[model samples]
Target: MREHRGFEALGQAVALAEPPLIESSARTDVGVHRRVNEDAVFADGGVYVVADGMGGHEAGDLASAAAIEPFRALAAAHGARDYRMVEATIELARRAVDTVSLRTERGAGCTLTGVVLIEHGGIPHWYVMNVGDSRVYLHSGAELTQLTVDHSLHAELLAEGRAEAADTPRNVITRALGSGDSRHDAWLLPVHAGGASWCALTG
Candidate 1:
């Protein structure tokens, strides 16, 4: 809850709130060894997405892009849809990814990570999602915390203490869009006004 600051002696100090202005940006790079970049980044109208294609998949690029297509469409036209809208959008994206796999017939798939802006009771909120190894982070004050867990063998091994994740070559994802597990981990979070987001790429 926001604290009411200052004295409200002047007729209760009535003030109107302005609608949040949505903003976003994105960037991606073809990794060192891949001939084709299998990662997709999308940011628009307060919707942000990053997807990585499954390694060795022939149509990974298409899968990654397809995973974000539904949200891309929603960015241009949306209202205060709440979580219902978010669930529908993700289903759309999953279907798009499935189409890509069927058209290619290559078992194509990709990891999905994203944050969508929505309104709840006239207040802005964020709908966050993740699948496979892609992740989302929340930065508050001096702490940056991971908000999603990886749906990968490496993560599972680490979680179960079966094996150390020091070398990930032995690891493979257990979930992805259009392949393996198709479930999306989702969260509804309050959007702190005046907060910002950015893209940070490592290798």
Candidate 2:
């Protein structure tokens, strides 16, 4: 997996073996304020995560970097072979972002998403999680599926049939890191076979 950083966005990539290293990328952006992107690799019931940060006047970069640092440390200490650890690492990122006190402005924040690769009795599986518009998609044979649902005002509107796909709210995320300390949300997704591959896309 890899993490890419930019002035306004963050990106991640993962390579799968059985899936033949299918081309996939995940990204998240907190508009002109912040962004984070993360990815994971699956093989032999293991996962790897990479988170990129992009927020803060001085703290935006710190927030993004801080979001991933703890997860990386946890992964290094405990390894991604355990699914529970994957979830823990995610929460850790959320908490890490929260711990970063905002210097000025409305506060520091970031977007995050990741995947966990696992195998149960020889069956390969994937577990996905996200907070914000960072996305996860699955492609099986000829059909592509969205594994992780987006958490944004636009998504809420889409769910209520009040908005079109092209009319989505611009970077209006309903949830994310450092948004607050009271609420936290994420998704647990399983990857299935039958010519299926997964991708996480965000705009």
Candidate 3:
């Protein structure tokens, strides 16, 4: 499984006139069974991403690196404030992963989950995206809300009432970069005071 750990200080602190500054910490591990960590994270230029390479695929680490490379460029070039640009950025990452798959001759892919901090009319908002089973969550005043849905067989089975949660295997994802049509889910969340958000990308 892929995991991340770090700390971030976001937003502005201007004498209490602005919204409270946000601070975050994240940590990642390769787990006991895996020899290498096939995960990538980008938390700069207002773009935060966590990508998990698909296990059992050759060059899984390369696949994840390819998926995140474009976002690094996106953050450097256009930043993450533009919603249209963020969408296009994801598409670019997908194509990069596809290129890796074509060259390796082995089905390679990764799960991507991230949030971009943007502004609309001077108000901050979060543009969240998900592919495969990575997740985003919001924490607010004793409430933890799941912000993205998992695209996984286990999730489907649970939704269809064909399996119980305890009996389902968690690693089987239904969608990913370099697989199928490469579609992804997205959301726009208005940032508010007294709350924070986090994400997890696991394969």
What TM-score goes with each of the models?
A: 0.81, 0.61, 0.81
Q: What range of 10 consecutive residues in model 1 has the weakest lDDT sum?
A: 1-10
What is the overall TM-score of model 2 with all chains considered together?
0.61
Q: Which stretches of candidate 2 lie over 4 Å from their true place?
A: 1-58, 77-80, 119-124, 163-168, 181-195
**lDDT (Cα, 0-100) at 89 in candidate 1:** 77
- 60 Cα displacement, candidate 1 (Å): 0.3
Highest-lDDT candidate? 3
Compared with the true structure, all predictions reach lDDT values of: 0.72, 0.52, 0.74
Ten-residue stretch with the least lDDT total in model 3: 1-10
- Give me the overall lDDT of model 1: 0.72
Clashes of 3: 7
Ranking by lDDT: 3, 1, 2
